[model samples]
Target: MSVIVLDKLTKDFKNGRGVFDVSISVKRGECYGFLGPNGAGKSTTMRHLMGFYQPQSGSATIDGLNCWRDQKQLQSKIGYLPGEIAFPVDMTGKNYIRMIAKMRGMKDLSYEKELEDFFEINPASELRRMSKGMKQKVGIILAFMHKPELLLLDEPSSGLDPLMQSKFIELMERFKKAGTTILLSSHMFEEVERTCDRIGIIKNGRMIQEINATELRHSRLKTFELECEEEADLNKLLVQFPKMLYDRQTRIVRISVPDSRINELIAALSVCRLRYLKEEKHTLEEYFMQFYGGKSNV
Candidate 1:
């Protein structure tokens, strides 16, 4: 069953800055990574799912409930961390947590305490005085403490240090193991790669690509770096593989081939006087860079 569904859900703003015709379906107990650059509609799509904005077209649903129409009931069952954190400055983190727990009718805070300790958060400080990272830790605890079956996190680790980021990934893995359905929206490739089963990349308010994590990990596509003994050797290899990137000055070539074409690569290289051939490691970040014209800023 699909725990979360967005069917052509769209919300257009006057400035042309909202999501357009976006569709996604997240199955029960599955984590779906909504990957995109900052301002690429990831947060907009998430806002629709959270029922914060009414879709201009189509619909958003969670467990068969209309997101906008059934927001009251849905809010109680979902754990959400917004991209932008906003808290009352005067309220202490401890008091804020207590207030939210009280509103949710939660009597026990044992799990909340556990999360605080795990994140090394000192919630006694006022929200106004806490650093961005500290406030982020508190937000994370609040989102997970209830143990809701559905989680929607938008850039959950934005303010986190590298260590805290890893800790967040571990927490996500634990949640998935406990059968929680999650929609994680972020620009970080590593975080998405580590926690999501499937990933969708959006650009300019539109989804451009969707990748299966398992397929991506086990893909037969491989890139190799080859050095030629002579400049002429590099020219011959380029004739065989026209798409190969050649550095004439260094006589080095870079080419990507599928497993089925390994023989073809070997044959092409065998004819060329080669110094050495090396297999280059590929990362999800590198793959994603293709969509942005080799730009890693995304």
Candidate 2:
């Protein structure tokens, strides 16, 4: 069953600055990666889900509950980490965490401590004194403390170091294994690629593409980079595969071959003296580039 659904959800902020006709469904136990560059309406869509803003058109729902109408009821059912966090400067991290927990009527904090230990953070310092990374750790702890069935994470690892980022990915993988549904908006391609089962790319406040992560990770079309011993050898190979991309200076040729044509490619390469050959795996970023005009702005 779909745990979250955004049906033609449009929230126009005038001059094309908000989500438009954005439609996506995240199934139960699924992690849906929301990909886009900055100001592409990812955060806007998430806000609608959180009931922070009512959509001008269409609707957002979680487990059949109307997001705007049932905002109060859904608050405790979801674990949300916003793109930007505003901390109470006067409160210590532990105090802030306690305050949120008190609002939710939570008694057990065993999971919270576990998360703190895993993230390697000491949340006893005042928010005003904490660094950006430390504040991010607190946000992560809050999001995961309740262990909600659904998680709405916007750039969850934003201020995290490389080590902490990997740790966050591992945490997502762990949650996914435990049947948690996630809507993750992120700029980090590696984390999204590692944890997401599917991805949706938004551009100009619209969902331009939705793709299966598995298909992208294991694409049938394979690109082989070949370095020929001689320029003549490279030229000979190109004659058979006219569409092959090559660098004349390096005598290196790059060709995309389908699995069915692998034998044919081998046969063609057998006639040419090649120095080296390796297949280039297709990545989510490469596929996503087509939507962003070839540059990885994300």
Q: Which candidate number maximizes TM-score?
A: 2
lDDT per model vs. reference: 0.89, 0.91
Candidate 1: deviation at residue 220, Å?
4.6
Number of the top candidate by lDDT? 2
Compute each candidate's TM-score over C-alphas: 0.80, 0.83
Count backbone overlaps in model 2.
0
CA RMSD, predictions in order: 5.0, 3.9
For candidate 2, list the clashing residue pairs, or say none: none
- Runs of candidate 1 with Cα error greater than 4 angstroms are 220-281, 293-298
Give the alpha carbon lDDT tens digit for every residue of 141-194 in model 1: 989999999999999999899999999999999999999999998877888888
Q: C-alpha displacement of 54 in model 2, angstroms?
A: 1.2
- Global fold similarity of model 1 (TM-score): 0.80
